[model samples]
Target: MSYHNKVVLVTGGGTGIGRATALLLAERGAIVAVNYSRSAAEAEETVQAIQQFGGQAIAIRADVSSNEEVVTMIKHIVKRFGTIDYLVNNASITRYIAMEDLDAVTEEAWDDLFAVNVKGMFNCARAAAPYLKAGKGAIVNVGSIAGMTGKGSSLPYAVSKAAVHGLTKSLAQALAPDVRVTGVAPGAVNTRWWAGKEEQMRALIRHLPLDRISAPEEIAALIAAVLEQPSMTGQILTIDNGQTL
Candidate 1:
């Protein structure tokens, strides 16, 4: 995709899939706005790496769940890059616990997950809607296969991602002819979420038709393709290696 001079905002761009998406856009000549909540150092690293590769990038710290912060982030991006051409809502949170262990899934856990996963996306979208409309931009939400089928993480996480799917469709309908919105639901990505328990991870992979988990870059490739496909909108592209099937 020709991203020359395009302004792309990626939430949670400090690491994992968000970082990968930012880098991919930057490599394609997009002006990447790397958004982070608390990972200042990591976000800086992502920006620096893009700079090293002769790509334009800037790191902005904002709690995406906060309307004021999201507004500020969009303002900063517009001030720097003119207008937003793409938005990658990749910021999310999760806490794994059994249904019987209600204590493990505290009210705080639910609040935190929803705040970042669902509310954060909403805030960013709300703030960026105007600029996106002006620029005819696209939104690519990072959902999870868990949202489509069963509980891949905690109940809160699954619910939040399902909301993301709904948000993607609704936004697509609302912003049609001006802006496009879609979701990319990945399954069993090899990120920090599965740091330890290699045995369990391996066992989980064995059941997959592809017999492996997805890499962050693999997901980034999908984001790049979606950005290029102008006719496609409101679609949830599932990248689960046929696991869900």
Candidate 2:
């Protein structure tokens, strides 16, 4: 129960990596705020699961891209939990668009992707920084192996995640004396996010030394470890099974 009595905010917690991280943290005794956009029912399901496990949790609906909404969400969570001990920026967007369909990757697409993948991460971090510093908390951002290499569904997605890694480093330097900031760059985790594209993902994973994709819980384990280790900060831990090499 390293996180017993701690409050953790997880954006996009309704599904995928975010959902796994939220549930795992709750099971380990952290009070979780399950943040979701357009997935109220799913978020509530996550909350219910935590309650059934005798853990504390609440479902919060907020589009992480909105600064106002993010601020309000953080305020509400702080009001309820007293303080935020950790914040996991796991919300991101990706779309499958071919390079030939340049129109498909329009300004709106770029903006939309950045709005969630990049701005959302920043907004949440800004809103939660004060409480995090107060609690000597940690920030774990969800980056991607796509950010480190040229392998994502879209160019914008890869760019946005790369920006996340930069954000992790900058924030860690800025908040070092008071808080810890780190990013987890996962490689081809098995989740609904990639459910229908197993073949493409398999080919991608084959290039990795492990020759297999990672599970959400496998990535969750690294995130939990980062939260537990007070000394690890300003680092992007890639759980890619040596994909980078």
Candidate 3:
């Protein structure tokens, strides 16, 4: 579909992958809604950048972990943009804990991780389902290579991402022939989440075929490509520089 007049909502659009996706989509002519939880400054900055470039955009505050908040956020977007064309469920959270430290993976931490990484996805998708269906829109959920290999920072994080992949497939089937649903599972990206683990990240990248971690913008571009494919659904594209191999 033509992005020139499409309306898009990007969760966690304040930083890293979300920010990159928001900016890129705005550049392509879409009216971007940048959603943020606590990163208000960053989200505002992103909106300003898009505006400066003569693109339509706005900053929305919401906690994806809460269904009520997500519902309100989607309604606000619809009120502002008339209708929705795309939803990018890119908000996620993870803790840097060694897999060996079983005690560190507390029940609370697991719940928190799933709440944002998995439930947050379902929340926004459920809220925006009607609008998306009306517009024959698309959704791109940001998953993780850790979900496929069970090799992320913690067991909870990996489990949550695995849930995201399953949700993508399930939603594709459930919302079929109307709103397309897909996912992107990325390996390590050089984002804020990778902070304080530079040595480990470099070590991991050395074994990858690409020998470099993905940039947030690179991942965003791929997400957009996935959304652009009208006939594709129920597929989780992997962009991990062959790290899984």
Q: TM-scores for all candidates?
A: 0.97, 0.95, 0.98
Runs off by more than 4 Å, candidate 3: none
Sort the candidates on lDDT, descending order. Answer: 3, 1, 2
Task: Count residue pairs with overlapping backbones in model 2.
Answer: 0
Q: On residues 53-83, what C-alpha lDDT tens digit does candidate 2 reach at each position?
A: 8999999999999999999999999999898
Give the worst 10-residue stretch by lDDT in candidate 1. 96-105
- Displacement of residue 149 (Cα, Å) in model 1 is 1.8
For lDDT, the strongest prediction is: 3
Q: What stretches of model 1 exceed 4 Å from their correct place? A: none
Candidate 1 similarity to native, TM-score: 0.97
Q: Supply the global lDDT for candidate 1.
A: 0.90
lDDT of 3 by residue, 112-168 (tens): 999999999999999999999999999999999999999788988998999999999
Query: Candidate 1: lDDT of 76?
Result: 87
lDDT, candidate 3, equals 0.93
Better structure of 1 and 3 per TM-score: 3
Per residue, candidate 1 scores C-alpha lDDT tens digits across 196-231 of 777878999989999889999999999999988889
Q: Quick one: how many clashes does candidate 3 have?
A: 0
